[model samples]
Target: MESKAICLGFLPPRLGFSSPHLLSRSPGSSTFATRQKFDSRQTLLWNKPQLSRGRVVCSSSNSESKPETNHSSKSNYARAELFRGKSGSVSFNGLTHQLVEESKLVSAPFQEEKGSFLWVLAPVVLISSLILPQFFLSGAIEASFKNDTVAEIVTSFCFETVFYAGLAIFLSVTDRVQRPYLDFSSKRWGLITGLRGYLTSAFLTMGLKVVVPVFAVYMTWPALGIDALIAVLPFLVGCAVQRVFEARLERRGSSCWPIVPIVFEVYRLYQVTRAATFVQRLMFMMKDAATTAEITERGVALVGLVVTLQFLAVMCLWSFITFLMRLFPSRPVEMTSPLSELLNLDLSDTKKIIAEYIWIGGSGMDIRSKARTLPGPVSDPTKLPKWNYDGSSTDQAAGDDSEVILYPQAIFKDPFRKGNNILVMCDAYTPAGDPIPTNNRNKAVKIFDHPNVKAEEPWFGIEQEYTLLKKDVKWPLGWPLGGFPGPQGPYYCAVGADKAFGRDIVDAHYKACLYSGLSIGGANGEVMPGQWEFQISPTVGIGAGDQLWVARYILERITEICGVIVSFDPKPIQGDWNGAAAHTNFSTKSMRKDGGLDLIKEAIKKLEVKHKQHIAAYGEGNERRLTGKHETADINTFSWGVANRGASVRVGRDTEKEGKGYFEDRRPSSNMDPYLVTSMIAETTIL
Candidate 1:
C-alpha cells in the first residue's frame, strides 16, 4: 500500500501540529493510522498537482480495493471525523504519540442564567417585609398604649432599627449602582472643608430636627412629656445602629458577620411585641375603672387617635432617618492626582488667616488691601495690623512722599469666610495717628460729636438700593440673556420663582449683614429684575455710616461669589426703569415729638437751599438716575411733598397725620457714601 499526506490550512493553531502527517489504512480494517511528519511548506508544492480526477491519490492499494472517487467532496467530512476520534497510540520514527479527541480539549464549564428573583424581587420583598412590619406594629402599640413610657421606648427602638436595617439592606443589595465619590485624602482639613462637610451633613440629617428637639428637651425637660422622648429616640437609635453596622462591615472578613445583627433585630421585635401586650392590658384595666359610657366613647375615639399618632410618628422617623443618612453619608473611594496635595496645602492649617482687608476712606470706592495672613483669635481690635497705601492712589494726597495709614476702627466677623476671618473697617490716618483731613469717615465722626448735633438726638434710616449686573454683559444679573424682560412692573417685593431673581444673593447679603452686627432691618426685591434693596434703620450718626459701609462691603463680597457686579450707579439702567437710591429718612428728638412736621418742613427748606451741594455729595453719575421720567425728581431741581415719590423730599403721610415722625430725603443716589451723606444731613438739618 502507498500513503499520501494532506495539509489543512484552516485548522486552528491550537491543534498542536503545524506539519502534515501521514494517514494509512490497513487492508480489511475500518480504522486509519496517521504517522510521519513534514513541514507545512513542503505540502504546498504538492497541493495543485496531487489531485487527479477530483480525488487525492496517496498510493495504490490492491486492484480489488480502489480509493474512494468521491474523496474530494468529503474532504472536510474526513478532517472532522479525524478530529472527533478518540485518542490512540501510534508509532512514528520509534516514538509513541497519543492522539486525543478534539472535543475533550475544548470543553468548558456550563454557566447557568441567574434568576431575576435574586437580583430585583428579593431586595424589594426583603425591604418591604422589614419596613411594613415595624410600621404596622408601631401603630398597634401607639393605639393600645398611647401614654405608656415603656411602650413608647420599645416601639421607637423597634421601628428605628427596622427602618435603618431596611436602608442598610437596600444599600448593600444595590451596591452595583454607581455613586458620586469624594476625594478627601488629598484635601487637608481646613475651614472650608470643615464647614462644607458640617453643612452638608447637617442639611442631610435635618439638623433642625435633631437640634430643636434636643435643645427643647434640654431647656424645658419638665414641660416636654414622653412625646419629646419618643420623637428623639428613633433618630438617636437609627444613627447609632447605622454607625455600628458601618464599623462592623469595614472590619468584617466574611459576609456571615452581618447576620448576627439580623438575629438581634428579630429579638428586639419580639420584646417590642411583649411590651405592647403588657401596655394594652394595663390600658384596658385603667379604662375599665372609669365609667362604662366613658370607656365606650374612648374606645371609639382611640382608632382615629392611633392613626393620627402613627402617621405623625412615621413621618418624623422617616424624615429623621433620611436626614441622618445624609448627615453620615457613605462615601465612595476616589482617586486623585499628586498635584492636588500641593494645591490643597492651605486646608491643612487650623489657624484663621486674614485673607483681605477693606479700606473705606477718602475715595467713595472700596479699596481692597493686599491679601495677608494673620493669627486666629485676634483679641484686641486695636492690635490689628495697620495698612498703608499711597494717598495719591485714593485721590486724597499729593503725589509726593505722603502715604495714607489705614487705622482699624472696628472688627466684624467675616460672613463670607468659612473660617475665622475678620472684616476690619478703617479710617484714614496720618503717620502721627491723627485722622486724615480728607477722611470722610473721620469727618462724619467729628460732625456727629459736634455740640449742635449732640442735642438733636438725630437718628437716620438709610434705604440702600442697588442693581446686580451680570459680570460681562452689564445686563441685570437675573434678566433674560439677550432681550429685556417685562417692563418695570410687578417686580417690587415680588414672590414666586418667575418674578424673583438674585434673591439668593439678597438673602445671603441680608444674613451677612445680620451676622456682622449691622442694624439691617429688612431686604426686598426692587422694581427691576435684578435690583434689590436692604434697609439700615435707626442707626445714630456715624454708627449708621459705619454699619452701612460694612454692610456694603459684605454685599460686594457676597456678589463676588455669585460672579455678578454690583452697580451703585444712581440709574444703573436708563430709560423708563426706576433709578437706585439710598433714600435717607431722618428725625430729631423734636421732630419725633409732638408737632414735628413743622420741624421736618424746616429741615426740608434748609435742604432745598443746598440742593446743589447735596446732589454733588450724593454720588457721581446722578444725572442719569434722577431724570424726571422715572420716579426720581430732576437732578437740577428740588421739591418736597407728603407721600410723594416724585418729590426730592417725601414726608411720609403718617408724619403728616401724626404731626410727628421722620422725613425722607429722596435725592441721594445709590452710590453716595453713607458717611458723607449722613454727615451732610446732620450738618444741614441738626447742626
Candidate 2:
C-alpha cells in the first residue's frame, strides 16, 4: 500500500523504455494487483553516470512554472526532491529487479506413467508363479486320497498346474501392459493408478512361491523327510529367504530399484476396479513431461490390495500345509496315554477311520447313527434317538401284538429299546381342570359347573408373609389379571379369586409371586414349581420305543372314559386287544399291554391334583384363573421376580378404556383341555 515515486533519471532518445505502466491493484486485495513479466533491457542513460539531458530540455519551460521543484542549489537536492509530495524518483538496480522476479517464480509439476511397465510386469510373474502351484498341489492331494488311477491323477495334476499357472501369468502380463493406459496425472481419480500398481506387485509375488519353496528344499535336503518337510514348511522357509535377500539388497544400496514400483503397478489395477478410478491415459502424458518422483494416488490404492493378497496367500498356504501334515501324522504323537496305546492311533490311522466313519444326516453337517459324530454339536435327543438292536428281528415280530414294532433297516438307525417314555416340558404351563369347588374331585363333573358352591359377600383379604427382614407384609392375593389394580405394581402379593374353584362366591387370599423370588423345596430347584413341572416329570428320562407305544395306548383307552389323565410309574405287561384295552388305533404289539390303562389314568389324576393345588395357592374363591381376579391371569407375577422386596415391577396403561385386562391366567379358564386334547386337533389337521 506504500507508493513511492522512483527516480530512473531521464530517458535517452530511442533507448526504448516508455513511462513505466501504472501498477493497478488486482480485484483481490490479498494478492498483488497485476503481474507482468519483467522486460530487462539497457538504456543509454543506464550505462552513463550522468542523467539524460534531451528529455530534460523538453520539460524546461514546464518545470520553470513550478519553481519549488528547482532545487539544484544543494548536493542533497535530488534525495530531498525524490519523495516530495507531488513527485519522486525511482532508482532500481539490476540485482534488486532480479530479486523481485525471483519472488514470483513457481516449481514444475508431477508425472504419471514414466516407469509403469516395470511397475506392472514384475508382480505379474511373481503372483502367477505362486498361486498356480498350490492349486495343482491341492488337486493332486485330493485325487490321491480318492484313490484315483495313477495315470489319471498324474494327468489331473499336470492339467491343473498348467491351467492356474497360465491364468496367473496372463493376469500379470495384462496388468503390466495396461499400466500405461491408466495414468495418475489428474488427482481427481487416484484409484485407477493404484489398481495398476497392485496388480503389478501381486504378479511379482508369484516368484516368492517359486524361490522360497526351492530354497527351503535346498536347506532341509539333509533331513530324513525333506520332501514332506518342504511341503509343510514352504511359507516359513520362503519368508526367511525373502528376509535375508531383502537385507542384502538393502546393504548393497540397491533397495529402491524400479522393480518394486513395477510390481506395485499391477496391484493398483485391482484397487481401481474394487475401489475407484482416477487419471486417464491422456492426462498422464502431460504430467510425465515433468517429475516422475511423486507417488500417484493410484499407486497407493494398488499397493494396499497387493499387500492384502500377499498376507492372505501366506496364511492360506500355512493352513493347507498344516492340514496335510495332520493327514500324514508325526512320529510318537502319544507317549504314555492308555487310551492312545489301546487304540494304537496315529494321525494317518485316525484319518482313515474318520474317512470310513463320518456320515452326513438329513441336515447339513448333522451326523446320524454311529458314524454321525464328525460334523457338529450333539444332536437333539427329541429329534434323534440312538439305534437299538435287541429282541427278535424286525421282520420276525412285525405282526406280533405283544412285541415291539421295529422300523426297517437303514444307513443310520435310532437307538432306543421298545417301551421307553419321552417327556418334554416347555417352561410355563397352564393347568387343565376346574378352578373352583376347592375339594371337588368329580370323576364325571362338567368342566364349567361346580358340584358344591359357597355363597358369601366379596371380601378382599391380605396374605401375611415374612419378607426380606422377616417382617410380615400384606400382599394382595389372587390371580393378578382379574384382581383390583392388577398385579403390575412393585408388590409380591396379588388379590383375587379362583375362577376354576366355582362361579358363586369370589375366592380370596391368592398370592401372585414371581418365580425368581421362589425357594423351591424339591428337585434341586432345577425346575420351576408350576403346572409344567408335573407335566414333564413323567417322561423326563424315559426313551421312546416299546414304553412310549404302551403309554400312548393306555392314554387312548383312558380318553374314552376320562376327561384328563397322567402316569407316575409305568411298567409294560402283555395283554390281548379286547374292549377298553384295545382303544388305540396302533397295531404295535408293544401297545397291547395290561394295567398300563389304569396307570395312565392315575397319572392324569395326579396332574389334576397339582393343578388344584396351584389354584388353591392363588386363593380360595378368587375367581381369577388359577388364583387371581376375573378371567385374566397375571403372567408377570410368576414369570418374573417382581413381587419380592426390591424386585422390579412394570405396569402398562390401556387408553382404549376396554374392561378386559391384558393379562390372562395360565389355567384352563384361558382354555380348558389346553393340553392332552390340544395336540389331538393338531394331529388331526396334519393327518
Best by TM-score: 1
The candidate scoring highest on lDDT is 1
**Per-model lDDT:** 0.59, 0.24
- TM-scores, in order shown? 0.49, 0.15
Q: Ten residues in a row with the worst lDDT in model 2?
A: 466-475
Q: What is candidate 2's lDDT per residue for 75-192, written digit by digit as tens?
A: 2100111111212112211111110011111111112333344445545656655456456565666566654234333433453345334433443333222221221111111122
| Candidate 2 global Cα RMSD | 39.4
Worst 10 residues of 1 by lDDT: 177-186
- What is the overall TM-score of model 1 with all chains considered together? 0.49
